[model samples]
Target: MESIYIQTPLGIAKIEGDKQGIATLSLVEDVALSNEIPSCLQEAVSQLNEYFSGERNAFDLHLNPQGTDFQKKVWKSLEEIPFGKTRTYLEQAKILGDVKAIRAVAAANGKNPLWIVLPCHRVIGSDGSLTGYAGGLWRKKWLLEHENPMRQQSLF
Candidate 1:
């Protein structure tokens, strides 16, 4: 296991991974330079930097997000969400052909560990409200506003 930290618009992120692929991305306010990053971490860090700078719309880095089968399903669905679009949990559940599993789908979404890399922030409340982002609702709001093409004035 190896880790590297980089500054992003949201904050500094510590990314960890091995040859298998990137495993964890933890957001922090500061970086600890005590650790040496593995060679494999460079590409992931570069790609993530591009993403935060708005130079990259989608991530191409090899990811090995670890989770349950249902969580994986939800994460994959999150990936399918376009760069600047939002989807409701109910809609996501219906897309999975299980409309009644809305709460389960939301739960799976909440457990998404890869954060912005997995695009879980694209999921919103059924009424188009931001809610339940592990990274915090403010970050979610910022992300949605960042991804919007029109850049509407925010009430926040």
Candidate 2:
């Protein structure tokens, strides 16, 4: 697997992948950014840069996140979430066809390997609050706001 570290608004992002596709794109704590980006990860890096800059709202790269079958299902559902929308854990569980699986669905979401590409940040608490993001609630808030910047209303 090839890996490259790049600086992002949230922090240092460590991306790893190979010909099989990108397996992981995770946030790391205080790592020196690398000048060289692996060929396999170049597209991902570029797309991520565009995403942070608000030039792109969707990703068009092959992903190969590693996780259990249930987790993969949950992650796939997360990808279906719109760029500027949010889904509650209960809603996600309902989509999975088992509202009783809310806790399990949240657990799977917590384990999502791909961050922005899979858009785990779009999931929020049932009460419309930010909660349970592996990258921290602050980062989650930043990501959501970045994706959907609030527009100022005219006071005419």
Candidate 3:
């Protein structure tokens, strides 16, 4: 798999994938991946920039994130979450047809390698508070605020 790191207002992010699709996008404190940016990565970088700039609401990149079957199921569920909307882990578990698997569902969410593209940041605690996120709670909060800004919140 090929990888390239890009700088964003949130922080430096490491994007890794190949012709098949983008697999991961992890926030990093530094750009340590010393490699040429591939054409696929350029598209991702542009979309990510548009996302951060609030000019784009949805991503159009082909993604082939790596993970176990269960994790893939969870990530796919996450994709169904509408932009600017949030869902609880329990709700996601219920959608997966097993309310008892809440913990496992949350675990899969935590293990989601694709980050924003997979929309794991859209999941929240049952009480509507931000919860676990591999990219850090601050980034999660920022993303939520970015997606659902104060004006948007007021509409509801």
Candidate 4:
């Protein structure tokens, strides 16, 4: 698999993938941006840039996240969550047809390898709270706000 590092508003992002598809993308600390982006990762780099800039609300790059069958199922379901929307872990479990699997669904989300592409940040706690996130709660909060920024109210 090919890999590249790029600077993002949040931090440095490490992306790994190949001609087949993008396998992983994650945030890392203290890493230099890649000097050159190979052809295989060019589209991903472009899409990621657009996403951070708010010009794009959805990802269109090929993805090949590595995971087990159950995890794959969970990830696929995550994709159904539209941009600018959030789902609680309990809601996700219910969507998966097993309301009792909230923790398991959250675990799978924690293990999601494709980062923003998988939209794991869209999941929250049942009480409208931000919960466990591999990228840290602050990053998760930033992403949630980024997707649906509140509009200012004006009074004349």
Candidate 5:
């Protein structure tokens, strides 16, 4: 597996993968930025840069996140979530055909390895509050606002 570290507004992003496609992309606090991106991860780096710059809303790179069957199902469902939108854990469970699986759904979401490519950050608390995010809540908020910048409504 090849890896490359790039600096983002949030922090350094470590991207790892190869011919099988990208297996992981996560933020790190301490990693030297690579002056050159690996051939296998170039596209991912480009898309991620575009995302941070607000030039891209969706990712289209090949992904190969490793996990169990249930986890894979949950991750796949996360991808279906539209850009600039949020879904509650309960809603995600329902979409998976098991509303009672909210806990499991949320757990799987937390374990998602591909980060932004899989869009686990789109999930929010039932009351519309930001919740658990491995990358940290602040990053989650930034991602959400980056996708859908809230506009001020002027009083008429």
Candidate 6:
């Protein structure tokens, strides 16, 4: 698999993929930025840069995240969430046709591998609270705020 590390507003982003598609896109504590991006990952990197710059609201890259069928289904559904919009875990479960699967849905969301592209960050708690995120709650908050068209105000 080919890989590349790029600087993002939040931190360094570690992107791994191959001809099949981008498999994993996650944040790493530290890593030197990649000087040369592989051809297979160039488009993904460009899209990500656009996303971070707010020029792009949706991703259109071929994704190949590895997971169980159920997980893939959940991730695909996550893509249905519109940019700058939020969905509660219960709402996501209902969208999947099984409100009782709320916990499972949230678990799958927590395991999402595509990061901002898949938009697991768009999912929140029933009470509109930011809950679980593999990239850390702070990053989650940052992502949600970034995607929000209404600028987030800073409190001193």
Predicted structure 2: clash tally: 0
TM for candidate 6 is 0.94
| TM-score per model over all chains | 0.90, 0.95, 0.90, 0.95, 0.94, 0.94
lDDT of 6 by residue, 1-156 (tens): 999999999899999999999999998976688899999999999999999888999999999999999999999999999988999999999989999999999999989988898999999998988998888899999988888889958897
Candidate 3 residue-wise lDDT, 28-66, digit = tens: 774465457788788998899899899987899999987
Model 1 has an lDDT value of 0.85
lDDT of 1 at 148: 80
Residue 22 C-alpha lDDT in model 1: 88
Give each model's whole-structure lDDT.
0.85, 0.92, 0.87, 0.93, 0.92, 0.92
Q: Compared to the true structure, candidate 5 yields what TM-score?
A: 0.94
Clashing pairs in 2: none
**Which digits, one per residue and each the tens of the lDDT, describe model 4 over residues 1-156?**
899999999899999999999999999888778999989999999999999998998999889999999999999998999999999999999999999898889999999999999999999998999998999999998898889857345676
Tens digits of per-residue lDDT, candidate 2, 101-152, equal 9999989988989989999899999899999999999999988988785745
Clashing pairs in 6: none
Q: How does model 1 score by TM-score?
A: 0.90
- Model 1 per-residue lDDT tens digits across residues 27-77: 876556425557989888778778777788898878888899988988889
lDDT for 54 in candidate 1 is 70
